[model samples]
Target: MKILIVGPSWVGDMVMSQSLYKRLLELHPNVLIDVLAPAWCKPILERMPEVNQAIEMPLGHGQFSLSQRWMLGKSLRDNHYDHAYILPNSAKSALIPLFAKVPKRTGWKGEMRYGLLNDLRPNRKIFQFMVERYVALAHSKSTMLSEVTIDDIPNPALNVDNENQLACLQRFNISPDLPIVGLCPGAEFGPAKRWPEQHYAYIAKQLITEGHQVCLFGGPKDKSVTEKIVKALSEHQKSMCFDLAGETSLVDAVDLLAACHTVFSNDSGLMHVAAAVNANIVAIYGSSSPMYTPPLSQKVRVVDTDINCRPCFKRECPLGHLKCLNELMPAKVLDAYRDLNRNQNLE
Candidate 1:
């Protein structure tokens, strides 16, 4: 069997999509799987052993260039894909599969994509986790997963490149002699999801005091906030801290994260990446809920607010108080951090 998947845009979502690809391979050992995703996500897909190819999408997000989609779809027709799984909910996401005239196109009822998908699922709420939803698409629409819970599904695990990791450390002039603590303080979503810079700086300083080297990780967009956190630290802490939020490529960040002893982050893509890399993680949740998309790691401590008005899931806090993340308290995160370290030591 051959399968083609239209992948999600965000880093976390792309990482989670591995579960579906894994399931497909498990069910059909000889099946060839290809993912149609953004160019930036190709490196991530390349890491997954189940994926045969990672085809880059030419058009930008929210771009409705019909000619481009049609041309790409035409280019793929000779591959003769047996099935296509559309991961995104947008109508445009299904266009490529339909244009390719794949035998079966599967997806949830998204927007006005009535004719776009042939194997339509009436609802997505049936599955709790996004991983489950993606994995479900691998099966027949009338069928259900043999293992009902998410625990039965495989978690995303990216293989490390040791040489590249060493090269990355050298490029950043960072020595791994001290225990590493990775802090991912940026969320591409918005400020509502980011913990305060001061809070992160506090954690970084405390970790450094305990003799741990701190590294701030994120995309280029996170450079400013990471700088803010580093700036708030004392000179000694700054010396021990490496701000590589915008410096390293996503591929480099993967290997770098695998080298960390522990990581702290607001609910973001890197948080999931850290979890996948087997980092002892302290995941902070502000406007987002952990129940839906908690880090897929056994050693994670998920911290969230108990306030009723929280988890509004908005990009920015509408009420403007921003108490959800602000009131979450840096001390609480420190406690989790310490507890994780203790547990790991015990093991």
Candidate 2:
């Protein structure tokens, strides 16, 4: 069967969506699976073995223009897909599949998409992990939702080659001998999601004291935040940390991250990428609850407080203290790091 999956635009959601693609491929190995995704997340879909093609969705956020929808619809119709699975909840997300007139359009019944999706799945009774929610769409009406464990999902294998890694290292003038620990300090959601910059500096300093090199990673918007993190580290510690935020492309960032022994990140895209590469990850959660969207890998260790106000799911914290993230001390994170290292050495 030829299938088209309308993937989520966010990095973490894209990573979680991989499980669904894998389950589909396992059930039907010969099926041609194409993904419609944002340009930023195309690299992620390209790395998944189940995805045959990654079609870039050009329509920007907010209300889609009628012309763009018609154009997209016509383009999808030409592909002749038997099935299209809409992953996002937005009403516009279902338009292309409906426009293409795919035989089977499946998704949860949100945004009142009665006409858009032919096979609407009820989510009221199914309270499970986000990965399971995505994968369940692949099941037939007769098929029962099997209990899925972390083992059922495969790790994200980045498509980057060794030459790409070497080139990126050379471009940055990064020494091959140094042991790198990648630090991703920015969370796009809000300030409530970000751990204190001084805390990161403290952790980086500690890592350097232990003779490990540190590399900061983030997008262009996070350049100032990354600078603050580096500046806060002690002068001796500063030499050990390289501020690569806003400097590297997504592809280059993946390559550089793949080279790290471990990655410390806020609950962001880099955290998911680090997990894809099977790097030992320390994922910090703040305002957002980990229950709904924890890193989907055993290689990751999540640190979060049991604060009542936490998991508010808001862009910014309603309370000024921001204790959900603020309470999680750097000492706790360093402890997790030590434990991860010990386990790795034994393995």
Candidate 3:
């Protein structure tokens, strides 16, 4: 079986899509799965054992570029893909599969993609987790996603690059000598999802005081936020914390995260990556609900409040106070982290 997957754009979504690829391989052991995603996704896709190849998608998200899409799609015809699984819902996402003339193109019924996808699934809400939704498409259209239990689905596990891990530790002057605790305090979604910088600093100080080296991780947009967290720390605490935000590539972060003893994170891409790397995780949820996209790690403690206005799923706090995060203190996440470590020790 030769399959082509039009992968999702976001880091978390891309990580979760591995479940679908794993399912495809399980159903057809000899399947050759090639993912078509943005060039940014190449590093991630390369780490998935199920993916045979990672084909770079030249166009950016929300870009129509009809001529470019046609050209790119036409270029893949020679691969003779038997099936194409489009992970993104955008109508533009399906154009390549259509142009490639794959025998079967599968995806959820989304935007004006009626004719674009021949094997379209509906009622996407039936599946709760994003991973489940992606994995469900691997089954026949008649399959009931609701009937699929969480344990039945495969959790994404990214293969750690040990060589790159050593390189990153050396390049960043990170000491693997002491236990490392990583902090992912940035959320691309917006301020509503971000936990207070002081809260993160508190957690970092606590961890460092416990003799753990702390490393902060995020994209370029999050550099300033990470800086604020570091500034909040005392000079001694600052010496123990490595502000790695905007410093490493996505793949480098993945490699380094795998080396951490634990990770304290907001509901962000690195949180998902940490889960995939099997890091002990303190997944702090704010405006976003864990019910939708919980970290898929057995060694995770999901911390969230029962604030009524929460799970608003807004980019910014519509209520303005941002109580969902501000009210949920760092002590709670600290307790969760301790509990996670306790469980790990027991195991």
- Residue 295 lDDT (model 3): 90
- So what's the TM-score on candidate 3? 0.98
Q: Global lDDT of each model?
A: 0.90, 0.83, 0.91
Candidate 1 residue-wise lDDT, 1-347, digit = tens: 88999999999999988888888888899999999999989989888888999999988889999999999999999999999999999999999998898989999999999999989988988988888888888778667656546888888888889999889888887886768889999999999999999899999888899888999999899999999998898898889999998888889999999989899988898888888888999999999888778888789888878989988999999999889999988899999888988999999
Please give the lDDT score at residue 342 for candidate 1.
Answer: 97
- Give the Å shift of residue 231 in candidate 1: 1.1
TM-score of each candidate? 0.98, 0.95, 0.98
Q: Of the candidates shown, which would achieve the greatest lDDT relative to the real structure? A: 3
Model 1 misplacement above 4 A: none
Error of 2 at 215 (Å): 0.8
| Residue lDDT tens for model 3, 1-347 | 89999999988889988988888888899999999999988999999999999999999878899999999899999999999999999899999999998989999989999999999888788877788888888888776555455678889999998999999999988897989999999998899899999899888888889888999999999999899988988899888899998999999999999999899888988899999999999999999988889898789899988889989999999989999999998888888888989989998
| Model 2 segments more than 4 A misplaced | 141-144, 147-151
Say which prediction, candidate 1 or candidate 2, comes out ahead on TM-score: 1
